[model samples]
Target: MSDLILHHYPMSPFAEKIRAVLGYKQLAYQSVLMPRVMPKPELQALTGGYRRAPVLQIGADVYCDTALICDVLEHRASTPTLYPPAVKGATRIIAQWADTSLFWAAMAYNLSPKGAAALFAGTPEAVAKAFVQDRAAMAVGMTRLRPGDATAAYRSYLRRLANMLSDQPYLLGDAPSLADFSAYHPLWFSRVINPVMADILDATPGLLPWMDSIAAFGHGRPAELSPLDAIAVAAANTPAPLADEPFVDEHGIPLGSRVTVTPEIFGHEATEGELLAATRMHYTLRRQDERAGTLHVHFPRIGYVLRKAEG
Candidate 1:
């Protein structure tokens, strides 16, 4: 097995989720720091164009999306399972809610005028404007929650989480599962990154203790790896072999077709490549770049759109 390399920035919420998972699993990995915004050429080379944060790279296999990354981690280290056999289904469903609805609401509330001002306090005006524009581009078609609406929704969600935590040490049970990690990251952003806007968390007394417990799981042992070196690692190796299962084609598209896969919501950049595997749960794209060579990029099926590439 190739060394696990995570390409991420320090402040990415999704990356934080993966970091905590790494900590819980006690796994050591290589850290490839990435820019917070666009022009991520090296990272894009590995992913084709799925420019989401916290992409897990193993040799030439690139795993996009934290959900899939968590799955991969679970496979890599199965002792402390993210999905307990007793409540696996419920844990996954709650994780989905946390990643989507709860995440948006918490972020909107955190980036409100006051929060934004605090976030960019000493930063130059141009830099702040660019950040705003970049995020706007990513969220083009999605209906974002207004600041006021987000506050209300966030408050309600926090209370619900408080209720959940009141009984158990962790969300699904005594041990922290996928639900705890998923639910913690967005709130982690609010509390850690945008502390100025984190007062909303005060209302739910039970939530803070839970947050503390989750935060205690520091990021796993990470050795810094330059982006260039990470790319070199991919270019030097071949992608891992795929399973021999029959192609599960739902789009009338056959295997080996030129296709594009993109997120249906935010960060809708398309990655075009030869369709290598279209399993029920995910899609694998085989794309080559001058610097990254032949890489197999993987994306979860739920939040992405798959279409045959136009010639």
Candidate 2:
């Protein structure tokens, strides 16, 4: 099997989710540290325009979005399985909620005046400005929870998580699953990203111990690989075989149509390209990045929109 190459930065919460999974599985993978901001020519090569942090690259196929990435990883390493058969559906639903609602609430509160200062501290003023602008664009249509609201929601969620932990070591059971990873990242940002602001965790004690348990599974042995080297590997190797799942029509756009896909909110702007493949879980677009040559830009079906271009 071709090496699993992860493109991510240190501070990305979603990236932490993947890293923790890797750690839990004790999987060996190639690490390609990418820029948190733009000018990521190599990433643009792999993803086209979906510049979300922590993309997984496998041979010539790149998987975008952590949800899809988790699925891909589960297939690769089944031990310490993320999805348990008994509660797969329930676990997934919980993960989805944690990723979005819980994530936003925690982040909004974390980025309040004090936390933002702590996060971008010592960084250049322009860096902070650019980050602010970039995030603002991502939040175009959605009304974000104000800091006060976020604090309340975050506290409530933390208590709820603590309650879940009160009975068992992990959220659902004795072992950590998808629910644990999904739930951990947001709190991770709160506690690890800015511990000064992490006083919020004091309200719910069980969450703190759970955080330590999850954190103990550090990202497993990561062999350093340059972006150029990684790209060459992809260009040289054949894409892994995908399951023969027929394309189910959901968007009303037929096969071979030119289309665009974009997040429904937060990074809401669209990326235009030729529609290549629309599977049950993802949409792939063939796009030409000036340096990356022709690449398939993929996006998860959830939290995004797909539309055909008007002639």
RMSD of each: 1.1, 1.8
Highest TM-score model number: 1
**TM-score, prediction 2:** 0.94
Q: What Cα-based lDDT does every candidate model obtain?
A: 0.93, 0.85
Please list the residue runs of candidate 2 whose C-alpha ends up more than 4 Å from where it truly belongs after superposition: 288-290
lDDT of 2 by residue, 7-113 (tens): 99999999999999999988989999998776677876777667778899877777888998998899899988999888899789999999999999999999999
Cα-based TM-score, every candidate: 0.98, 0.94
The deviation in Å at residue 16 for candidate 1 is 0.3
What is the Å distance of residue 183 in model 1 from its true position?
0.2
User: What is the Å distance of residue 250 in model 2 from its true position?
Assistant: 1.2
* Weakest lDDT window of 10 consecutive positions for candidate 1: 241-250
